[model samples]
Target: MPGGDISDLDKNRVLAQWLEWQLRQVRNRIRELEVQELKDKRRAEQARAGQRWKIQPQRSNVAALLHRGDCSLYSSEMGFLDREEAIIALAEPDIEACQICKPETGLVQT
Candidate 1:
């Protein structure tokens, strides 16, 4: 009877260790999934924001020129271009050429 009881205790210890390891694996997987979900949500929000911008355009002639490759001028400093310069460049009466390109401002400003 004594030997049988010791064997049972050993079996129980092994089972408990296995269960603990499985639970840890499950918790780690859940954490990984949560991080992936947050990343996916951020990407979706960015896509939605881009779509909104497409729906409504910002008013700036420099923006339009930058959208096209006709002019090689680009702002080297980090700030919003003066509104007057944008207006003048965009309002050129004779530059009716169309070029295919995307507008890229280096950074967003508050």
Candidate 2:
């Protein structure tokens, strides 16, 4: 009203256009971020798939993977072992326990 003739009934078309442009930019950025997120998730899934519960070198195809009863095992292998076994695994000479899980600290060695 103060600038010039009423562009429309009273709608601020210029402001709407600017807002629309800003919204589009935000949406594009969101899409980029989502793609990155999906990539990270897929990468994580792939890594998980490769992760093994037992990392011991097999002497033969018939080589027995450590049993659940056996406390000693590999640091890479923990998916199957419970909390107690995890600690035991760390105690073994060959097996290195996970630092994050700290399998050895709370465990009672016998």
Candidate 3:
């Protein structure tokens, strides 16, 4: 109880405990970051996928409808249809879905 001697076994145990605590903290931080990263990745993927089917208005020089296409490559004469409104937009006069992507097929059957 009085002096300057700590046993080697005691020192080893203390060291092991400290190391374990540090490892736990590091693992927890990594897990938290990984979960956040996964969420961010999913959000980004959803945005990109939505962009794929975004319907752009296709029109003739006389302002009549031709067909809808993706926003990825659209003409200045065309208009953009919001993703939420795509089904309705596709139903508009002469605005058929693109022959390639077929956005209309994805709409609900009803």
Candidate 4:
């Protein structure tokens, strides 16, 4: 009966090791998925940032402001401007490009 007891102990040890390995595999997969999710989130943010431009209309005493799509200084919930629209906006006498985002850096004629 002692030999049978030893056999049971060995089987239990093997089972514990297998379970630990499986746990490690699951943990590793979770980490990989987390990394993938982060990358996808960043990609989506970049897509939103580069896809369009926004303008803040003139306020009481302030001129209208132009901003990059990703600019944090001013947020306009109105429709976004395309490249040509941005260029035209920059040409307006009262519209000025945002200093922080420099929305006219690429759009202005040299």
Candidate 5:
């Protein structure tokens, strides 16, 4: 056999090594994809499980505020703030600032 020419045994060995490397790469990619899928599934499940209630303030006060136009009720269709965050903003004195009337009285007068 010529020194430059690959023997059958040498070619077989090289082919085996190449196939092994390819399989390893494929397996690594599969594992990575599986791990990412699991993570995404866990995140989605957690989001579903941690459901939050819509903000429903005490009726009379909210009605009064709405009636007087002292406070504006954000529409559900509005994209600005979530109900929970809006409620929190309402409850917190520091966050509640009147846009039109007296800035001192944070709570909307009705």
Candidate 6:
């Protein structure tokens, strides 16, 4: 009754528009959070990778190559090797250290 009479339909339309705007904002926030979550997950994975090592199987006549877990030259879905395990792998005559990442640099020779 104050500030002129407004139709019920107009009020409903305005309410619907406000609800839609709120929904969009919520969805945008969800998307941003999802992106942040993905980044955190990737960073965690990289950190884990850095602490481990991996072996790329020999291809053709080439010997198996040892690499730092974070090395991108070879991607292995297989389990990683621990520090001692990496040293052991390096000891193998058939296993060669990666020239790029130089996985042997992290190990101490006994």
- List per-prediction Cα lDDT, in the order shown: 0.46, 0.54, 0.60, 0.87, 0.48, 0.92
Decoy 1 TM-score against native? 0.45
| The candidate that achieves the highest TM-score relative to the unseen native structure | 6
- Give per-residue CA lDDT, model 1, range 46-72, as digits (tens): 544432211012346633332222223
Candidate 2 residue pairs in backbone clash: 53-77
Distance from true location, Cα of 94 in model 3, Å: 8.9
Sort order, TM-score high to low: 6, 4, 3, 5, 1, 2
- Which ten contiguous residues of candidate 5 have the minimum total lDDT? 63-72
Clash list (residue pairs), candidate 3: none
What local lDDT does model 1 show for residue 55?
9
lDDT of 2 by residue, 1-110 (tens): 67786867456787788899999999999999999999999788645533223334445443434333223444343455555555566556665544443334445455
Q: How well does each candidate superpose onto the true structure, as a TM-score?
A: 0.45, 0.40, 0.48, 0.70, 0.45, 0.85
Angstrom error of the Cα, residue 24, model 4: value is: 4.4
Comparison by lDDT, 2 against 3, better one = 3
Clashing pairs in 6: none
**Distance from true location, Cα of 82 in model 5, Å:** 18
TM-score (C-alpha) between model 6 and the true structure: 0.85
Off by over 4 Å in 6: 1-3
Off by over 4 Å in 5: 52-110
